[model samples]
Target: MIFRHTRLIMGTALLAVALPAVPAMAQDADEARIKKLEAEVRALQRKVFPGGDGRYFEPQIDSSAPVTTTSSSPASTTAVTDILARLDALEASLQRLTGQVEVNSNAVRDLESRLAALESGAAPAVAADNLLPDEQPLPAAAGPAPTPPPAPAASGPSAQRLAAVQAIAKPQTDDPGDDEYSYGFRLWNAGFYPEAQQQLAMFVEKYPRHPRATYGRNLLGRAYLDDGKPREAAPWFLKNYQEDRNAERAPDSLLYLAESMIALGDTNRACIALAEFGETYPAIAAGRLSNQYEANRKKVTCN
Candidate 1:
């Protein structure tokens, strides 16, 4: 009877162990089936959506079948994480593309605006005539005016007699004689700017026949410039250049003329002046004005 009891106990223990192993084997088989289904789903996704990174996974179970909570939860969480990551990556790519497009759009707009501005003819003015026709001509004296005769000799060397002798002995200065050429220099030295201007203008008008008149005109323009009036100086500079292109002061006057035109925003005229300067006086221009000529040449824009 004891042997029969021992056999029954051993059999019960063996059955308990065997029953636990049965569920384990079934679980392992189910896991392998799940792996196979996953591989098939991956292949189908690759075939349906070629070259696409998006993926989908589904278990092969009847609609009415009960799903184990623990098995489904991990897979569902993994799929959700993968989808969220893919969505974030897609959004990042879209943002980068959008930024690039915006940059290109702004560059195109800037170029279009530049083209429009160029087409609109917003350039320097070309006046009807550079010089005003109605402006005052330089002053000129009618040929030598009649001179008054010397008064009768005074009796003695009184103040009036001395003054009369002194006046008579003083050489005639009204004439544009050799002394007149130095009039501008004297006035400048004496700090008489107004008188210097008048004398220089008179020299330009009356002594235009003189060889030094061209120099005087240049000085007159410089005088106006020293007085802080480039507009007023430009005409005299132009006249000096017109009167004597080969004068010693001609190139200087032309240079000043270009400067005046630049001040007046007359870039076209400045360009012309620069070109003329380069062509007319090559030696002096090459030495002194190369940079200015190049700058003005660059500033010129033609339609």
Candidate 2:
């Protein structure tokens, strides 16, 4: 669990850092080429997991058969019911992780936008070459060398356009009102999960509808994950997923939910989570889900 949480943080950071480079590096290439590559990757992923959509980034899971748990006494049944209830809570936590992943995905998009801005802002090394004036140098022999025309200065509009592009290409600014969220993230980055959780919880409450609410929830889930509380993280991740269904985070939420279930020794629900991840985000499902699926399958009770 600790390793998983660390990987999640590193992955998010890497994605955020890498996205901005795409536009800056590929500016000279045809836009069609860029889109084509993305399309090709999406297509390939979909092909790998037949019937997969390219929208979300969920992983696949095993779908062989359901296992039946035998319980005789009423107390045994009630305990089973309690386990199922815990599973429900786990599901909810995963939704929150989904939201955080979405926020990270959006950040990548924003970075891409900034890269485009950088590409567009780069001015030509030299103004349009004046062939007529430069080679001839001034026709002194032809006539009284006309006053060498002064070089034309760049227009104001061009300058303004450059400034606008540069501004747009810069990273997103921190929200002034989200001080607590900021603090929470800082603590999370520093490995203080408990303090981070408390701060993040307050941030969610104080700014329930703020733009960073999804991110806050996501961080909260991460806090739980880092604390080795996958079950607690499940509901938050799930909430994040539902709130932002199309976000990259949704599939991630599903993935973690399944993991949490497996950890709690609930193979059936884990499979259910994995299957849902594949169904909702097929493109991502097959590539990321195999290991978890196999692991859970080994523990299955049903034939």
Clashes of each: 0, 27
After superposition, the stretches of candidate 2 with alpha carbons farther than 4 Å from their true spots are: 1-174, 177-179, 286-303
Scored by lDDT, the top model is 1
| Candidate 1: tens digits of C-alpha lDDT, residues 1-303 | 546544644654554445544578775755564555454444444443444333433433433455333345577789889999999999999999999999999978865554343222212343557647743332211223111123346743468644643343213365654345566756645544545576677666677778677777777777766766565676677667766788888888877777766766777666566666776789877777667656655666523
Query: Model 2: C-alpha RMSD to truth?
Result: 40.1
Model 1 spans with C-alpha error above 4 angstroms: 1-178, 189-192, 288-303
Worst 10 residues of 1 by lDDT: 139-148
TM-scores across all candidates?
0.39, 0.37
> Which stretch of 10 consecutive residues in model 2 shows the poorest summed lDDT?
138-147
